[model samples]
Target: MNLKTKLFGEVYQFGSVKEVLAKANEEKSGDKLAGIAAENALERIAAKEVLSQLTIADLRNNPVVDYDEDEVTRVIQDAVNEKIYNEVKNWTIADLREYIIGLDTGDLELKRISRGLTSEVIAGVTKLMSTLDLVHTAKKLEITATCNTTIGKKGTLATRLQPNHTTDDIEGIELSLYEGLSYGMGDAVLGLNPVDDSIDSVSRIYTLFDEVKNKWEIPTQTCVLAHVTTVMECIKRGVPVDLVFQSIAGSQKGNEAFGFNDKIIEEAYELALKEGTAFGPNVMYFETGQGSELSSDAHHGADQLVMEARCYGYAKKYNPYLVNTVVGFIGPEYLYNSKQVIRAGLEDHFMGKLTGISMGVDICHTNHMKTDANDLEILATLLGAAEVNYVIGVPGGDDIMLNYQTPSYQDDATLRSLFNRHPIKEFEEWMEKMGLIENGKYTERFGDASIFFGK
Candidate 1:
């Protein structure tokens, strides 16, 4: 089948799904986004085709995924269908397909993440290692991938600004940012979930942050997670719109609910390029998860992981700056347990990286999941090792407003210690000069841990 090139917008055809994406990854010149768009388009069409191979009977017969056996390697080796052999390969036909698709997407970073994840699955079923012991080994997988790098640039600790719901007044805004920056968590852009869709609320948060930024000289951009329409209004009203925020869904219909279609997305992107700072060329920020489609009943029967990857395809069109996969927040419907959540998180991070978008995660869970800080920590450590761009640094890992638990500044420190990663160089230099971080080391004396500012 033929698809339009993301760079030149020309139609190109590959005889098979594998060839389509394989060719795309090989093109390394001209506009890089075009190469990325080609890879994304490859995954989009490839996933749809892979999903078609499974019959109701096949899925029903293989419903239980946590079951362990070495049959996957056997199934991949034995499958005579050229399609399965070429584009699919391990745990079940579905997992096997996705694992291979991620590896094939021509992004070495994703391949590394997938390599780690599938190893755990294979070892679990193969009696090679107990699933309970599927820790640390995933850290062995590595890659040399780079994006515009929002919070944690490549090979460094990642950080972000998640100030509750960002419904605070100017004073509150300044204080919260001071707290995070004091802890060296401002390398990533400052992002907030606006309390409502009102353009006033959106403008107020942006204005407050901008004001605080100038007053305190905090080098960060701000995002009020208002609707795309609200952000568009902010742009027209001449308010500061640094990073365009929206909760994106896998299907077109799900996105339509938020007033974002191709036309609106393109328009918002063009506007942001002319306006936003601290990230783009592509300053749009998106939040996505696996169950969003099924939660909204727009999944169209595809697996949650693949469906979520499709959202990346949609996101690449606008060339987003940050796409956060809030892994465990959707409760137990799509990802039922920590195992599933961990796997899905890695898959989301992997797939997004493969599509050539600057990516990060909340590394979070809601009150309703079978996951917790321990589980989130395990995933965070591994994803950090995978060289993911960033994670949310909420105060003490508790979001009083969103009612979820995410990684804290302390956790960010642990990741930095574990991976030898610091914030991006600009922020890192600032930290060094301010004595928040001394000689590339974060000392306790940088700032008072409570109720005070640093630097």
Candidate 2:
């Protein structure tokens, strides 16, 4: 309840829990744009100092939005295991941070601790962690989910092969898809970000994905990243939908901005379970990013980091197979440059893992952002080191449709080899069976899209 701290012979007092959370965050353009960020470095540290002393119960009791007013807050609060919550309710934020990073802590204990944490507490502790701290703690946790294949195995990394075309050209998409698969990509899912989200266009793309998946007997899932409604309609029409995709937000208002409520998301999940084509209990794919709520004017005075973490809390209820933060796609207003982008990629991956979800990252940047391939490669290497469940793979790290740069097909292969990691076990075997790999290296057929055409 006390939001005051002394630093450098000055008293820094924040107005409320919201203010403290916002001020303690590392510099972000979105927070500055919102006019809620700390005015100076000393004030930022003061906020962190004050935030570290707050109790878990204090954060839980003061949900970012009133529980009655926001379904997101309700979902986060209602999901907390009360017994587990009680065990850590009195722990200070600093204590929670050290406990997580402590030498004695490992995957199982972290999972247990995750169940008791609200998204606010997660954000609070994250604000106090250094970049390496995020990586070290995240690397210690193992979170995996099964759709067609299990992902996030300790020695494995995965990629979502995004074969997007500027004009929804099936041939172009096919060419890109074949190229990506030849490089041993698409173990997570052969998902496309359609230039067209219409029913006809979306359905046609899904049909293509289905046919290719069946024809090659690829040991992976497929999807078109259309809106949830269009995807639900496709499923209702008996289209092959291995996974349901949606871009979700942290607050109910923000979700509304995305044109969905919990009801729609629940309906989509139920429909996928009853009618979709995946093999598992996990079949949802969610995308979240920092600054989305602020962009939509739905942040409700909370920092983007807290809002981002709430996204994980909301996604947790549905048990998504893939939940990736499109880390740098929201432009420089939210993430600014390379340093902030890399920091957010690590933060999101770490938070998603701690929230008990299979998390990935789209290590990306837009054209106008002060970033380039070098920055993205640095981030990809860091996430690779953190043992992320997956990262997005486009043909050349450029989504012609979305107009952003992500990891390329070659980048994914290099990451796996560099880390001595493999794709999902089944996909790896399939690649081996197809002679795409030998002696743990790509064979002569690698990068040849023509191979899938039997030429």
Candidate 3:
């Protein structure tokens, strides 16, 4: 059996590419123009070879290939460009499935293909859904918490640090307190950053995981365990983990304390594979933003170079299971200008070359009351346009405390309406419109009963 048959079973094949193209052409046109256009598209699809043998040098050199970036920009621009002469066609679900199959079968060389193809695919899917009016109603959102022990301060609720709360305290509060807040409102994935404090970090993380797993019953797959400390702990514990470069800034100062060097990253992957755990780098968070004191533009450019180099190097060394990046606040400096935050995020994505990064582009500090609905909508749109895999945020950060004294938005339809109007609603709507339904449809499919009682 072929790869697709093996994965999708015998019922998977819908139609041949040629037949589907012919039908599409016939549905749209009585003139030869449609037929000619369909033929050209078919030819383009066939002419592009799917698979190619790659050398370490090819992977290393691709990031710096220095093609007119304008050319790349133009390709993507043309995909979205609306001029009559510059129109780009959209692909159907069938077409997308076939393309994914081609990639899976090693018929397409993923790395060599223009990143523009990814953009085109996303745009095509978005347009197709709009044209069909088949968009879903439920919205999906990802909320991540970043805890930095070194800073001596926990993050706010959404991006808040995991308190140095003891294992017991974490267990007592995490499931009943935070889980409801996260689940009652939106789709959430907690990101634990265990920086330097190994014993305490691992113990607390394991405890939190246990509470989430046993008490709340969160699936292991849904929870992302990101380790910013040593890789050996990850290996010893046999946990699928994301490796973050927390010590990069310190490394620049000739301090090895928290830095994740190339060797360590490589070792993490090798060990992960041996232990049957997925491993990927979280470089975008450490290298970009104010942490390095680089200007937003400069920081983005330099960070991309560094991420590409490291990602390419690692991919060359030992094909990673996945590639991931974090798009959150580097420090308090970003609070000064929200535009800078948006710019920094876009730049962070460009630096990563937008491939193999599973779950890229998370909002670092999005809880402040000053973060308007327009800004949130913009952030959602930007993340969607960039083809970012996921985004994380809290419904009420420091701004909207959800303690017993403070009323939760759950009961307030007015507050929920406020959320539904601007960025919150826009983000959810955009995801649904684009057919990214994983996060949003959780409640609809599972029902509220699962939250209170697992049945």
Question: Which has the greatest TM-score?
Answer: 2
The sequence of per-residue lDDT tens digits that candidate 3 reaches over residues 406-435 is 122232222323333212233234334333
Q: Which segments of candidate 1 are over 4 A away from where they belong? A: 1-152, 165-167, 277-279, 447-455
Candidate 3 residue runs with Cα over 4 Å from true position: 1-111, 114-168, 176-189, 194-196, 214-218, 222-231, 237-257, 276-328, 332-336, 350-353, 366-373, 398-450, 453-455
Q: What is the C-alpha lDDT of each candidate?
A: 0.59, 0.93, 0.31
lDDT of 3 at 342: 50
lDDT per residue (tens digit) for residues 277-314 in model 2: 99879999999999999999999999999999999999
Candidate achieving the largest lDDT: 2
Superposition-based RMSD of candidate 3 using all C-alpha atoms, in angstroms: 17.6
> Lowest summed-lDDT stretch of 10 residues in model 1?
25-34
TM-score of 3: 0.44
Regions more than 4 Å wrong, model 2: none
- List TM-scores for all candidates, in order: 0.69, 0.99, 0.44
List per-candidate RMSD values in Å: 13.6, 0.8, 17.6
Name the better of 1 and 2 by TM-score.
2
